[model samples]
Target: MPQRTVDTVIFDLGGVIMSNGKPSDFASRFPEADRERVIEIIMGPYGQDSDHPWHRVERGEITMEECRSLNRDAIIESGIMPILSTMQPQGQESSSTGGISFNFSLSEPMVQLIHELRDNDFRIGVLTNNVREFREWWWPLMDFETVFDTVVDSSEVGLRKPNPAIYHLTMDRLGATPSRTAFLDDLQSNVDAASALGMHGIRVDDDPSAAIAQTRLLVQL
Candidate 1:
């Protein structure tokens, strides 16, 4: 492990430290879909100031229940649902996905790594674009009190990632600065957001061991 002058480590929840718990079938709905296309159609393109239903849910302006209903209506009314319905939902893919996966389980390796970081005095935090019902399912993954010093969930904060405000808020909660924090996420766009603000953005996807190694490299006691 290589040591750096980092005081805090911020991680995204869904794909980084957790097995992205999306219904395996939902992902296979569009086998040939490109990442960009999936975002554009599923929840509008990535960026701040989105009126997309997912954004609204993350912002706490709408509930996840409402977002799902709205999504189905829009897809059906726009004739997108007919096309989607024809495709059979297959097994899940291991590649990067720009959307949120509601089904998540804790990764033991990640949990151990986090505990080690915490024990070493590195402030640990989680910045996730999660739904309102997140605690119900995610709490069992790890003991939040022992592992995380702060957690900024989009649904409660009315802010989401790739947006500058959320990043600032997270750093503020951890009492760290942009340069002193190391951020990790599965999405390039979210990583870019953190990088733009001077945080070390470590990207992880598909392969957990490689991702963990990358994190350990930057985080040495």
Candidate 2:
């Protein structure tokens, strides 16, 4: 197949355009708990769309409160609740009953890049596996309506990342084909999925400069 020039760029919300809020990032809050185990119980195999409470919440199949209840129960049963309790009191301001905060900040660098892409006429879109309740928290971070051609929230659409359908949906909404699109995500699995569909996938790390540079190169900005 002939090469296609990139015209569309898709971004993942958390850890990409926004500061980190992944399971690992949350796990770090509980220094007393096993980080890997904490991440597993909280996120429940994020690389795949499963019946895990976290995944269900992301798909809008269940409410965040319900998922939190479920996760709390699991933590209690696993004997980690006590450790978490020592960190913070119950009913405190937290993303979950486990007291892990979901607080995140917008990445100014990524925001600037989005503006640059828009100025250069590249179609921009956001595909995020986000919670419905947390929409209010992230929406105000950016003028999304003006910046993005489309914003596909997993909670709104019942599909999440690493699931090929969502990628196709974003591409369809952007009126861009896979070969002519570039996707940036913090998760390697998500990036790999986009690459599998023929889109240029760029993984954003702690320092987004590398991913930003890669994206500019791919789109020849």
Candidate 3:
């Protein structure tokens, strides 16, 4: 076990604190045809292309409407005209109770751990890489300002994780030093980035309860 030098703790929202109710979760919202079409689109050229509109959506450069238009165009280019009506309905799912809902409500153990950390006077932050369109729903659930001393969203900052600048921005915003911070992320790439920056990075994954226990042990909390 690593010795505790952790003065700050940073968490990633999606897949860490909350689930990413993305295409899979939204699938039931659409008609069978639309769902099949969407699956095809995701598994085809659009998925292969880094410059796909989905990337634009992820980077916050495009609005949902713009992305939808772009996706519709992509489908057309693929020699299929996607039924926009079906797609529209899928996008109408409520933000609050969608597939992306936080599971922590059922994981009381994790919730208590979070409260314990806060009570122990640790500085905490929430950093997430997310599409801007879902902010209205996701942000309120995370309650960044209430649970964390600082919040870093890639959509708002234009720099996503695995990117050192985003990490620097978080540090700068919180006036924290990398050496004193412990970063938790479900992604190894993000964890590696934080570790490279001289921060303690814990990869939180399946059996996150064990991971959390390990984390508490790491920081000697």
- Best-matching candidate per TM-score: 2
lDDT of 1 by residue, 1-221 (tens): 45567878998887776866432224345566554454565566555659988778778888666777777765565443323432223553222122233345677777778888988889999998876755665767677766699989888898999898999999999999988889988878899999999999988766678777877777664
TM-score computed on alpha carbons, candidate 2: 0.89
Candidate 2, residues 68-136: lDDT per residue as tens digits?
A: 888888887777643343334366565543344345688899999999999988899999999887775
* lDDT against the true structure, each candidate: 0.73, 0.85, 0.66
Q: Which pairs of residues collide in candidate 3? A: none
How does model 1 score by TM-score?
A: 0.80
Cα lDDT, model 3, residue 106: 21
> What is the number of residue pairs that collide in model 1?
1
Query: Native-vs-model 3 lDDT?
Result: 0.66
Best by lDDT: 2
RMSD of each: 6.0, 3.6, 5.8
Question: Which lDDT tens digits does candidate 3 get at residues 89-115?
Answer: 443554432223222222345556677
Error of 1 at 19 (Å): 1.5
The Cα error of candidate 2 at residue 205, in Å, is 0.5
Separately for all candidates shown, the number of backbone clashes (residues 3 or more apart, or on different chains) is: 1, 0, 0
